[model samples]
Target: MTFDRQDLSNETLLHLYQHLLRPRLIEEKMLILLRQGKVSKWFSGIGQEAISVGSTLALEADEYILPLHRNLGVFTGREVPLGRLFAQWQGKRTGFTKGRDRSFHFGTNEHHIVGMISHLGPQLAVAGGIALADLLDKKPKVTLTYSGDGGASEGDFHEALNVAAVWQLPVIFMIENNGYGLSTPSNEQFRFKSFVDKGPAYGMEAVQVDGNNVLEVYTTVKRLAEDLRENPRPVLVEALTFRMRGHEEASGTKYVPQSLMEEWAAKDPVENYEKWLLAEGILTETARHSIRETIKAAIEAGLQEADAVPMPTADIQEEIADMYQPFEAPVTDAPAGSAAPDKRFIDAISEGLKQSMERYPDLVLMGQDIADYGGVFKITEGFVAAFGKSRVRNTPLCESAIVGIGLGLSIKKKKSMVEMQFADFVTCGFNQIVNNLAKSHYRWGQNADVVIRMPTGAGSAAGPFHSQSNEAWFTHVPGLKVVYPSNPHDAKGLLCAAFEDPNPVLYFEHKMLYRSMSGPVPAAYYTTPIGQAALAAEGDELSIITYGMGVRWALEVCQDLGVSADVLDLRTLLPWDQEAVRRTVEKNGRVLILHEDTMTGGIGGEIAAWIGENCFEHLDAPVRRVASLDTAIPFAPPLEAAFLPQQRLREQVQALRNY
Candidate 1:
């Protein structure tokens, strides 16, 4: 409670108290709307309002705030209109999310707030990335991230905090320890004496505050915020509070002990703070009463306005379609077909990344062991010295957090590229990639312009852990674009194309083809069109549609058989060359879609289905597909090769050609 007395004017004190009560009043209004059948569901932070309000008050206007579903106070304090909050719940287009989401899930870049999704742990790393970006840009700012006790248990939580601590990021990790995580009590949730103690383990300053005491929480955060701005380092704050209500209104407090609830109720944050303010002569009773009355009036009017706001008509489609709008490239193709020397696939990709970074100073490359050691594959060799450690960062082995931080950096107008050590490990950060990074733009009109370089496909006997082709996982997500290039030229071109695109993209560079494949690649800056397929070979008998390693295999098979078959290399998988396939099938009348991933749910299946639907009449035969066996990638060379279906692809193609 050491904040300057001069700074603690009557207006400031009154505002603090009002902030503590605002969320509760809003919750009550939302409940009334729900009862009136105006809205659907809500997740209110009844007892956690004090920490939400106080923590937010410590932040400056320029800093970022990443709040979970319960941090309504943080949103309202950041000047998010309560009417918009109601509109989101009511699915009205006037809401911040434009009726795309229901719940406290919208954010505005102008407000310096990125609202949390259902999985709250990822936001911690995202906030840390923002803080890291601010430090790099020499901006005097800090990011504050919030999570509940339950969210703290997630691996993302640990990874994010560890990165923040290691980098000494100007980020504050605040855990609202609400005694219980849903129905699970603290005693059953963890073995630690207190959540604050965990911070020191990660080299962060740890403090446990009386979360119910608004003044204590505010002062603690203010001091930490000031120190962070001066000497940037992450801090951990555990605000010990109680749920007061169940996880949601429908759940009720049946699980919470009545005795415990009553005991905590006696220490109501608002009532106690109001009493202290009145006694200290900081807040007059009349003024305090007026503040409450004004807030109540606002809540009533805001709810009404939200209810009347109509659902968006055609706006969402317009926005989704706008994603396809092309950005004017800073540099175009080499003057009219200037020939460049051939480069290795690995070298081509590295060169392409280097060229893109040079063109856009804000372009960043981040991953594990990517600095001094270069990378597991050396794809970013000498990148640290060339781009500086700030741009070519060596992140900890926190997969999800790395992607999450990349997301944060991406939204701040910095072009970020994340190197997933291997495609298999991307699963660690699946929640962030699929939920936040992918959908952030569609949900809140914020650009998560991130390119994740996934060194994928198996042939090195590197085992299941290191080798995987998980492009289909991303292709399935609505907001993500998937790219899997087969050769040196396409690897360089498609990767650069991903950087230019203003949405999240998964760039799968086949490890099997990295050193093995070599072809002509332009030295000049250029982007191969994203949705187009490359016609590697042409003929009249059959069509072989494939991507990545499969394209090379298809070429070898068609040539060895001496069959007059057309070969199409689908360089970009998600926005796969649908038109190219249609044309090829129409001409050849027989087609085979192939890939390296497992058969049951591979991208080949999607292509096969599309062909079945779109070009059924043109088929001289059934559209065939070839993929790896439906199981974990075996470790043995013989087993792995057999599992992958590489050797047998030629036979399958031969049989189809003969038929």
Candidate 2:
């Protein structure tokens, strides 16, 4: 069946034709450059240009689009500056990612586009985040995201769809069924007749369209988006098409049957669209030649500009810069009065979150059972009532999708704090935390202004799944900030500080300390500077460096042994107080680093190595470390106690003092 072009104006027809033809020409040229070794790799959308161009043009300028690697038409359709796009493909410094990322892996906020990662399904959840932000603000904005048939099989796909459906978010999940996922045919991917059949399980509307007909794709998306603005909800669109080229230039199409390729070739969107445009008298031979020549000239100019751009250098100073946005703590005066009441560690954290919500109107809290249920620990018990359900939200058990949603909120200039009921479960969302949140600022200047509250540490007899000191895991990652506080005062202050910081901060709270630990907490809000260690006690003979529950053990051991020692609380582990460490090592001439994580890969080893490398001359004795045994926490009380560093810490400190 032919597309009806009678309603569309002549100018709109020409513009749509140009958008469809531009990506085709560019891809053809890039393939040539790839063969000549000028380009590293290329993913050609040769036969499926209509899906990208039509869907992109259907949205308003203010709306966001998350495009996949092969969606060159989306970039060109959005007018993303051909020169910069070409520069990005060439790995030149002038690109949107400053050459940090290759191809379309980087997003450009100026054009309202969030680029795709190699893990294609995660972006769907991120799109949900952006949609959620718009819903909260009551904006009539919609987000459109793309995925291939193969990507639909990923767990994140189902998670994202389920969350969007439950929340009634305004997002369009566009799946381009290109018949082949790399070399495997679509028959091998799933048993469903079509992607639309799976949408009913998600409780969302779904539709199928002729991907080769640009008009159908455009009209379908345009109509759906208009409806979504008035009534926010998720919808799935399956665009049936074919991949005319290999997944990448390196991977040939030898696996594709020639008969199937020929069948799809007859349905080429670009060629078919041009023929219809000509037959309808919207374009003459002269105009078509003129259009082709103009596009050719533009492609040459962009390539020339990109070729002139220089490559990035291996300068260490430049490489380290822009990893994180500079954050300055607001100066808050200490609350006065000896009458201030003592509070539990959990109460202090709750107070900080409450204060932050009051401070930042756009702050959002999300976690499993956080809203009505008040979370597993009751930290957000009254938050839903105070802040309302919009700000204090309950999330599904899908950690990866929730984390990606937090990132999406951050992308839209909203602040979010996600609570993990237990620290050990973070493994489920490790990719989003380490790869997306940690690298966003360094790779593309996008600050993931997120705070992840981790209920960490042992002694609760919660077994291996619920109890684990996992701060060391995040400290090893470059783009994250790790903070652990020992008492109520620091807990409140540091939690407030983490909320204010622009980078992603992992705030670790000891489960045992929630009720077992209590101290004086001021009523007013304040921020304890991250990366600053507090001097818990002062003595010149020996220094005990630790944080969290370890600080309590160190102080108790020092008092019990009658040893005059300097006890230091290293609040933030990522940017640990190196200067303070140096001063203590130089004065005491001995050091003992204590932690609750396993001894082998704990932060203690890193601190000891740094001291030995930088302060070896001043040391009277070798630096020592005391940590938990390299085994999982057991359910029994005795086994759990033995697995911790309580007794071991005492012996290590005494041994260091004697030495």
Candidate 3:
């Protein structure tokens, strides 16, 4: 049977066929290494080689792609060197990720490819964000994103599809329906006749094609991609294929039927295409043989070179985030002095976003109810009118996908500031933030200049879902900056700093302080230096270490008791002010760590340990902690106040004074 390629020349078809062999041969060598224990494990897209290479051949060299765990052809077709590929696979220090990541997880800015996570669906939304950027900039580009049938069932898939369609993003959402998720078949995952059918429901042009037929995938993608670059419409192509291998090397895959495996083997994409190539006189037997032999030898040489490189030694520095890097942009005068205009903390944050967007043209604001409604807290009030809708977008309630889309946009050199409606609800998108956004910096030295705005802390009976001070969650993570600013000055300053720094930042804004607190806030651009603490009140007795609303409480209690104390407000959490803590503790001879989070397993423990080691000799009393009781935040106002740390604050201060 003859196949149609629209207008692809024989030479292009022959070249595409050779591209197919590259990944196949390299992965074949990888399997050998896995068996020999030279490499860790493998996630092979072995059986579906044609779709992998053909779709890649269809796109322009400069166009962007966000690939999944499979699709090794993406790297090979993009001209990522075989040695770097093997070294990364072998977990060598010479690898593209510098031995920081495993599997097919690395990216190069030169190629404009963003490596994917094992939880594959987030990349779909990320690609949408990138497409949004290209659309805003009026660049002639189309983003190609990959997903699996099982991944299509994920919430991120629908979220990504909806956002892409609503915004009219220039992205092609390609799903490789490989018949299985892991061990379970697609029948168990979804009941739809075809995953492609759901795409139109998301307002996208959808199509299904035989993925094994290289010409079919190439022609379909090529036609859609050409239109996408100019028109900026999102399309969904479901490539019908099957996974001949298990999910990974260790996964036995005994669940697959022998007859089904045999059937797919008969229709193997590589073998089927080779016959078509020879029948059409597109490639000679000698040429095809030479292609395999060339790649095989190259893969072998790369493996040998990787073997010669020493295993990377462990470095503690990699685990610590680069939080305090000096800003690349020129610094305006610091927004200090008591003569500055008085403003509420919430207003300061809004002004900061406004000034930041004005200073940095690429700065974008996105979140739920943030555009017209001014967000749930009104922190982004009037932003849509001032910056226009494109800069200030209202996203669907897909929290994880929101973060995922922001990450994708950041990969393309756009700065994104996303709002987590309530800090407690950020858990919905935790995987994308921690795994994808946080790791990108250390893995390949790629900075995700994304800032996640979290309205945190419990007050005003917002209860369990709306109120939570989960700052410790991010402080424990590597390659992430945790900023919890208390007063209006620091809130505006640190937020500007978060925007300037080239890293992922979790800026936690306390909900309680939004309306209740007021202080001098400068209108001009400035940064509250990260990795440092501010002295709220200077005194020679009793070191008070606190952050967020705890700062307010500490100052109030100290003034109430008429005690002379050194109150230190930790502006940033991850890189806490250790120097300030040591000096203040040594000078005062007593200490108290205060926070609104629960007592057990809080960040206070880390601080206590630090004081124990560094300034043990200078302490007059044991370093004490005053935090909320160990209980879920209650809904009732009285219960909530009782559960929080008001009683602890008064008792801890008096105890330190008596000591």
Candidate 4:
């Protein structure tokens, strides 16, 4: 928070001024393009340039950065060409993303500037993960992420912060308090007056500074970046800056009172810094005018070149398309009907992890409590001894960092198998999952080959925060492969298959079924085909389509009621077993879809609707759906029992009788 003006060489000062000036000109030109409807949209960082530029220049070449939309300063400082930036805005082929990505969706593997995500909190974890990679590689580098005050209120922000602090991650969290998120000011969204105060609560040192002053931003960030290599811990820099423009182009300044704009404009960071430079004889009015004109001309030429460029052809677009060779059916000793005695679901997972790691030396297992603690449910016991700590390593309690590091390693051609303590906790790394891992392949034509194991589903009475089936949140994304395993065979087989798949796969394991279910699994290294379903049981009455814990519960209810039920386990949700569901419904007289997720917008509903529209003629009854209520998972045992699917098989029997 302390600021003492240190003398800088003229060359360094000029370089700083030039970096800030270029992005400002580009912003102004983008606004003009915005008004003309030439560019899609523009996010202007007029007053926040100093922070972005200053922080960026403080780091070395190999350090990682995840910038928010208003980080043109970072891009400029990194020497990302103005022509490339304009091409992206114009949706031209010359754009870094080859016209597939939008203007703000730019990234470079060589530059180490990871793409910016539209979501708020994911970058916190991703940056932490990058730092984790550096620590593992024995490299001297830090990861920095930028977010606005509004984004700080998200669950991911707090979750990532807590994890980073607990693990003492080498990360610098930069909160650019730009006064407002759209129309809502920071005060309206948060109870605390300043975000820096929350850093200590997460066990980190925080500094507040005048973001408008270039020297102040540069010096503070430089000091923190250096401290990271020695006494490594997460740092929070809450930069008090103002937004000179609205949230985006077309979002006018009409929402703000004229007096307020005038007041802030009088202390504009660009002008304030310029005045300071001139007063100190570091810069002259002529020099400032020349800098502005030079940048303006450069932006003009860049825009002209971008407009003339062609759109990316489809061939160029798919060059980096994710491709994975699906696993062939394995020859096993257990025949169909060679059923084994029931066992705990966690036992299957432990076996699965063991089998996968043994099969593929590249498959590494990591997460909090997953090693010595054997996971929250004893799913990874004796893994460290079996595979050694290098492979089955226990990470610091930083979820975002864990996932983010997985991403960095995956991009470096290393296979990573990560575990989230619980499904609900995955929200901490949502940004990394959604923004970086999910879109990396499609965005830059390279796959982030990573596997994330989420122990999900309810009925454990672990309460709302601990137990929840939120897999559908990820199934909706295009590039992510989502798998929910219901039994021992599928848990091991699907995970093995996921390791082979090129895209990022979210393997959702049921916590309730961990100890209550068991089945025959192949002892050898084997993998099942990704996106394929299994017909667990065959019957004449109805087809029960389900996955995870629902598969086990449905089968149990069928046996107890002595009903002839056909059950289909949809092992993968994204590339769902649509064909299998249709063929099964065609053979069975009725169709029943069941899941443990919330009723509204759950995967079961989507499947049922697809069946109703596609196979309505084959059914003897309407597709029946049984799902949890549209509410957070409850803590009380009885209430949770009522919330999750418990009687779907009986319901199917009753429906058959009615039919």
- For each candidate, how many residue pairs have backbone atoms clashing (under 3 Å)? 0, 0, 0, 10
lDDT of 1 by residue, 1-659 (tens): 22233467777777898888888888877778777777677676877788889989978877889988788888888878877777777888888777777786767888888888887788898897788789889987889989888889989999999989888898888899987778888888888989878987998889999888877788889989998899999999999888777787788889887899998888777777877887888888898788889999999888778767777777666776644333554454655677788899999999899999998898888888988899988988888888898888888899999888888887677889889888899889899889988788778788788898888889899888988878888888877888888888888888888888888888988887888878988878788878789898999999989888888888888788788888899888777888998999999999988888889888888889999999999999988888899889889999998999777688788778877
The residue-level lDDT of candidate 2 at 134 comes to 98
Instruction: State model 3's lDDT.
Output: 0.85
Instruction: Write down the lDDT of every candidate, Cα atoms only.
Output: 0.84, 0.91, 0.85, 0.78
* Cα lDDT of model 2 by residue, 542-601, tens digit: 999999999999899999999899899999998899999998889899899999999989
RMSD from true fold, candidate 1 = 2.1
Q: After superposition, how far is residue 557 of candidate 2 from its true place, in Å?
A: 1.3
Per-model TM values vs. the true structure: 0.96, 0.98, 0.96, 0.81
Top candidate, metric TM-score: 2
For residues 268-349, what per-residue lDDT tens digits would candidate 4 score against the true structure? 6676767767887888989988988888888888777887887766773355343322234454334445545544566666
For the record, the alpha-carbon RMSD of candidate 4 to the native fold, in angstroms, is 5.0
Q: In angstroms, how far off is 102's CA in candidate 1? A: 1.7
Each candidate: RMSD? 2.1, 1.3, 2.0, 5.0
Q: How many Å off is the CA of 386 in candidate 3? A: 1.4
lDDT of 2 at 225: 100
Error of 2 at 636 (Å): 1.3
Of the candidates numbered 3 and 4, which has the greater lDDT value? 3
**Quick one: best lDDT, which candidate?**
2
Off by over 4 Å in 2: 335-339
